[model samples]
Target: MIPIRDTAPCHSRPVVTWSLIVVCTVIFIVMQWLPYEVSYRLIHLYGMVPLRYSNPDWALAQGLPFDGYLSFLTNLFLHGNWLHLITNMWFLWIFADNVEDRMGRVRFLIFYILCGLFATYLQWYFDRTLEIPVVGASGALAGVLGAYFFLYPMARVILLPIPFIPFIFNVPAIAFLGIWVIIQLHNATTSVVFKGVSVDVAWWAHLGGFIAGILLYRYFIKPQAEE
Candidate 1:
């Protein structure tokens, strides 16, 4: 399943959400100017790694400032490529306005950052010895989707069947998000059984953010009055 846009209307302009997307885009542009080795080193320094938690001092010595606490915030902004940055920012644009509309700007920003941090740790806990850097806004954006599910389960999502396919249709948020969660769970489960590790994507982070969004739904989103 894919999501094109949501049918719900926003009461106010989603300034923070848009601002975040712009900032990420600008940062991506700047990153592109840098040498690949430099960019890789920068991502490695700031991105989350499960091994960092085992010994804070060693992690800090490796350029993880403030004993790795800062990575939780910084990692969300880093992405591997144009596709990574674009897809994440695209989802944020599509789903975040309604969530921000429900929580208000300041609270929504806090909720988003916290969700990203918590999701990063959740991924780390599942694989404590991995050395690969966890970057991108996918996990954080998953939280946005999760929150959207709770606040607007009945809202319609216009989704394109595939990137190349012109066919599009609308589906309830719950069904779309439910399928998303199921796919991630399947990948996570299979990764554990076969590879004994998460190689590419941090599926555990998606699980973490999904659960966090579900748990915090009551506090984070307020439903609009019925028409």
Candidate 2:
């Protein structure tokens, strides 16, 4: 089922969420304008490649920055295509406002970065020698979903069971997120996350980020008065 939006109210402006969407959109637009070869090279350089971290000699031989660790963060802002950018940004727009409101802007951003780093770490752990550039905001957004799963368990999510039959319904946040977890785990067990240029979903990264967000959100969340 596809999620439409959640029935939750935000008390403050989601500045961080809006900014993240704009930055990711702009980056994707610029990448679309660039030549395919250049964009491909950029993905390899900036996207999180597990092999790059696993084999220092291989990384050096390929002229990749063996010591540069920024890819874990940068990879979150990159996308494979318009569909990728849209789907991720849509989910972010839907759930992140409330999360940001709860965590405040600065703490929210930090939590986001940490989740992405942890997400990439999980992907790397599973296949340290895989030679593919894993890029997209799904892993990080999975963290946001994780937060939303706990932060708004009572909230109802509008879901479309079918693509285009004009059918939609409301479901508890816990149920929606629980189904999502199941799907990701099912996929992860069957296949690894990396595909060629298309950059298929990284199930391990999703689970990692989701787990991280659940485990780490308390540290970043503000009290009721603070929020």
Candidate 3:
């Protein structure tokens, strides 16, 4: 289901969220203009490759860039294609503002980066042998979804469950995000148990980020008077 928007209102301007969206969009445009080979190499260098960090020597032998731990954060700014970028940015735009409003600008930024890092590492843990470069802001955005789930469990969400039919409906935040997490869990389990299944999405990363956001959000939440 595609989320159209949410009912939760934010009193504070989401500076960090807007800035992140602009930066990701600009980076995506720059990536599209770069030569194919350069773009490919850039993604490898910046995008998180589980094997790159898992087996540093092997990665170096294969001529893959091993830039310490930078990719964990850098990968959040990279996207494989236009569709990938758009989907992530769309989710971020919808949910992140409310999260940033509650956490404040600097704290939200820090929370985002930390959640992305946690998500990347969890992905690496699942399949350290995989050499494919993992890119996109979904993991971090998953964190925002997590925060939203907690902060606005009753907030109404507009969803388009049937794309072609254009049937939209309102659902509670808890039900919406609950279903999302369940789908991720099911896919993650299926991928691990069935080796032949070729699931491209980072289900584990999404799950981990969501959980992290739930656990860490209370620490960053502003008091009632402050809000």
Best by lDDT: 3
Off by over 4 Å in 3: none
* TM-score leader: 3
Per-residue error (Å), model 1, residue 226: 17
Clashing pairs in 1: none
Off by over 4 Å in 2: 192-199
* Full candidate order by lDDT, most accurate first: 3, 2, 1
Clashing pairs in 3: none
lDDT of 1 by residue, 1-227 (tens): 56788899998999999998998888788888999989887877778776777666766777655443677778888888888898899889999999998888887888888788788888888777777788888778888888988889999999998888899999988898889999888887787788655368889888888777777756755435511
Candidate 2 lDDT tens digits, 51-146? 999998898788787656889889999998889899999999999999999999999999998898899899889768778888888888989989
The candidate 3 region of ten consecutive residues with least summed lDDT is 60-69
Model 1 segments more than 4 A misplaced: 55-66, 222-227
Per-candidate local distance difference test: 0.82, 0.88, 0.89
TM-score head-to-head 1 vs 3, winner? 3
Give the lowest summed-lDDT range of ten residues in model 2.
191-200
Give the clash count for each candidate.
0, 0, 0
lDDT of 3 by residue, 187-214 (tens): 9889899997997888888988887788
The local distance difference test score of model 2 is 0.88
What TM-score does structure 1 among the candidates reach? 0.90
